[model samples]
Target: HAVVDTTGAGDLYAAGVLFGLSRGAAPDHAARLGSIAAAEVISHLGARPRMDLVAVAKSILG
Candidate 1:
């Protein structure tokens, strides 16, 4: 994704990593989730998600 902003990228990454860990994902997988979340946040103008993260995760994991 094209980067528009960097605000809250770290926080979103942490959130994604924690979420993945809570769901029993492997370390690399968790980090992948974190990367995905950070990518999403940086692609837009704000820290808030513009799309459904659940859907994004499902699509990626599946």
Candidate 2:
């Protein structure tokens, strides 16, 4: 199947990694963050739709 709207996938992935690192998360964990963020963007219409991943991670970790 042909993919559509792959525009901001990279940006959202990078944002996840950066946000993870900002919160002192490990590399693998950060990568998971990237994966989750990328998945979210792909599921939705846009990339990085103002969702607070950091907060989400914090809730999960805590």
Candidate 3:
């Protein structure tokens, strides 16, 4: 992804991993979600996501 910012990437990554674990995902799957979250955050101008993250994750993880 084209990184436009680095803010909140770590936080988003942690959040993703936690969310995945809470949803009963495996460790590697959780980490993959975390990475996807981090990548999404960094691909924009701010710490917030510009796209629908749940949909994005579903599209990717499903």
Give the winner by TM-score. 1
**Overall lDDT per candidate, in order of appearance:** 0.84, 0.73, 0.84
TM-scores of all predicted structures: 0.86, 0.72, 0.85
After best superposition, candidate 1 residue 22: deviation in angstroms?
0.3
Cα RMSD of all models vs. native, in order, equals 1.4, 3.0, 1.5
Query: Any residue pairs clashing in model 1, and if so which?
Result: none
Q: What tens digits encode model 1's per-residue C-alpha lDDT throughout 1-62?
A: 57899998999899888888888888888889889888889998988978787777666566
> Compared to the true structure, candidate 3 yields what TM-score?
0.85
Off by over 4 Å in 2: 1-4, 50-52
The segments of candidate 3 whose C-alpha lies over 4 angstroms from its true place after superposition are 59-62
What is candidate 1's TM-score against the reference? 0.86
All candidates in order of lDDT, best leading = 3, 1, 2
lDDT tens per residue, model 3, 3-48: 7899999999998888788877888988888998899999888899
lDDT (10s digit) by residue, model 2, range 1-62: 23446668788789888878888888888888887777666766655455777677676545
Candidate order, TM-score descending? 1, 3, 2
